[model samples]
Target: MPVFNNKDITLHYATFGDKDKPALLFSNSLGTSYQMWQPQIDVLQNAYFIICYDTRGHGQSSAPKGPYSIEQLGQDVIDLLEHLDINKAFFCGISMGGMTGQWLAINHPERFHHLMLCNTAAKIGNEAAWLERAQLVRAQGLKPIADTAASRWFTPSFIENNPAVIKQLSDTLAAGSPEGYASCCEALAKADTREQLKNIEVAITVLAGEQDPITTVSDGQYMVDRIANARLATIDASHISNIEQTQVFNQLIQQYLV
Candidate 1:
């Protein structure tokens, strides 16, 4: 349970596999913890030194006040890597983490070898929708949105078939801190990296879930089109494709990183 104290915020991080191997940092989606990456870690750990962390305001990390910025979220990753003495690593992030990955490759390209952005967009949803959702979460709780979110996370067929997995993921979402979740919502609301995508000159791979309602395959294409040396990889799953299609997801990532 290593904690990287980044001034106002504290990030909880974990590492796996051999320290000598090339590093591959996995950043999870919004409202989920580092545990969300377990499926990939189970297989890819042998080839790469895997690093996963609970983003600020989620899963054992500090939940500061509302209205967080994308730069703030991106800085957390930078600080964590610096604290661990990691100079550079391949970054793989999904959803909100993908948004963070965009900022990293754009603002700090020197710190990464490659970027893997999954199930995310340069500009997610409209600011109004995100602000409204944040307001709703602050007023009520994450439980109200948890079920609907779960639906968007996985396909209906997968949800129906994997009852235990759905419950586990949904429960994790429901248990998130309201302030933390809302703060991230604020970050998403203000985030619009469409203009900055062209500036990212790093080798990048953009992944999208075929059935993802949150961020569709078209969104991934938009990123691939903007970045200079980038390509697209489509997964036959929903938003949380890593969990719904673990084997395929793991294989794609391992292939790309190598």
Candidate 2:
């Protein structure tokens, strides 16, 4: 129920674990809330001070005008850290969140000790594809994409076996404001961090989903190849690899952070 007051926007955030522990910030993907990291919080709470926040245009955060930039998103994180009097924290982001992480690691290098990019890319999709999706969501609704979100988010086998998880995520996605979701789509459409990879000097770990169609393993490798002190790990899951392969995801992060 806590919120960080930015100049133009109000961001909703939650924290777990003790204040004395090292800080870890978690950012969510498009169409997801901070709740998406519940599984991670469950395991990491004992070892780290876990911070989770809803991105602008998603969850309870204020959604301003259309088409937010990665820089804006990254700055929000900086603002949040400043609000909490935090100097540095370990940062983890997936999909849209990862794109924001790239911006932060490149422009605000001192803000993070380690950066973990999960199932994301420097440039997610082509300009045309993201634009089209944005238009579709604006004209129709989140339901249009939420209907097939499971397919994009998880493997067919995982979807078949985990109906409840699929339902829960899809519901959350569908509940998002169409305007907010579409604005984020426009942000992703124009976001191209490929050129900034070399600027990231912090220790980095990039994980990709083997079965993911949205952000594949190849995308992860592309990042690791460009960033110094970076390595790529492949998980046997889809775009939402953290959820589909929770234990493996947690173990990889725990090992990498330590």
Candidate 3:
């Protein structure tokens, strides 16, 4: 676990594959860390410079109390890229990370050659809803709200077949810093990339899970319709579809990259 200082925050990062090849940076969801992309890392690293890191307050990264905006989160990516001297690369993000990708592509379109957006939306949900949820979590704790969140993130059938996977991912939510998680939840509530989505002219792959309850296929469809050259694919899992359906998720992403 190597750490990079971006002045404001230190990012905990790890890499795999050839450094000479074009890079692929993985930005994770609100409750997740870099490890969420484990399924893709092993397969894609050989061909691409694969980098994954915990965001400002998630995983092993330093947690700075923030009422952070989407642009600020996007700047975190920019800061890290400059730190590593990475001028251009492919950008991939999931959920909260996907929101950051929207920011990256909009703010630094020239820096990204392609985009991979998984289980995310331009506007996740209304501000009132997320703020309410944040307040509830802050007052009641994550475990009390975990079951409801799990249901929204995974399918009922998935919940039946893979209890252990659900439990593991849910546990990650439990370990999350309340302040960090709540702030991100608030970010999602206020996030609106509709105008920015229209501005994205680069090739983008909007991948979603057919069974995803959080960011629905409908959300991905909106992205596909908005971005000029965006293509859409539907996997057979939930919000954390890549980990939930590794082989299928990896294959779809691999095909997109090729």
Candidate 4:
């Protein structure tokens, strides 16, 4: 349990493979811990030094107060890099993590070599919906969201075939801190990078899920179109494509690193 203190929060992160290898940092999606990247770490660890961290308010990380901002999330990454004594690394993020990646690319372009944004959007759902969800989570805790998360996170077939995996993730979500989850919801509510996408100059790859209802392929394309040095790649999965299609996702990431 490697933890680093950043301002008001303590972030938990794990690293794998040789330190001399090229560093590849992973940021998990909302409601997931750094364990969500295990599938990727299993495959890429031999080649790259893989770093995975639980974002503030999730997993082992401390959930401070309400309404975390995207800038705060982005700054956390910068702080982590400095703590590790690494000047730069390749970055990958999903959903809310992807939004953080976008903010980093725009604000700290010099600190990364390449960025992969998966199953995310420049502007996720409307602010009202996010705020309402935050309120609901605060009132009733994570059970309601956990109950409905499968439908949004995985395709019907994947959910049916991968019951164990789905259960583990849902259970993690159900057991998570309500305040932490709600605070992240508030962050997503205010995180809109649609106008700022064009300013990102770092090389980028947008990994879209063909059947993601939450953040559609069109959203990925919207990002690819706006970012100066970005391209789109599609996989036949839903929101959590990396878990749904691990081999293909790993291959794509390896190819991008090459």
**Please, what are the lDDT tens digits per residue for candidate 1 over residues 99-179?**
999999999999999999999999999999999999999999999988777787889899899999888888988999999
Instruction: State how far residue 48 of model 4 sits from its true place (Å).
Output: 0.5
Which has the higher TM-score value, candidate number 1 or candidate number 4? 4
lDDT by residue for model 3 over 1-258, one digit each (tens)? Answer: 789987768889988888898888999988878888888998888888998999877888887776667877899898888877899988889889989998888889888888899999989878999999888877876777666667877777878888887787788888877777777777787789987789888789999888887889999999899899899989888888887788988787678765
Worst 10 residues of 2 by lDDT: 62-71
Q: Candidate 4, after superposition: displacement of residue 60 in Å?
A: 0.5
Q: Whose lDDT is greatest here? A: 4
Candidates by lDDT, descending order: 4, 1, 2, 3
> What is the lDDT for 149 in model 2?
90
Colliding pairs, model 3: none
Model 2: residues with Cα > 4 Å off, grouped in runs:
none
Candidate 4 per-residue C-alpha lDDT over 1-258 given as tens digits, one digit per residue, 9 for 90 to 100: 799987899999999999899999999999999899999999899999999999999999999988889999999999999999889899999999999999999999999999999999999999899999999999999999999999999999999999999999999999998989999999999999999998989999999999999999999999999999999999999999999999999999999965
User: Pick by TM-score: which candidate is best?
Assistant: 4
Q: Encode model 2's per-residue lDDT on 167-202: one tens digit a residue.
A: 999999999989889888888999998888988899
Q: 1 or 2: which has the higher lDDT?
A: 1
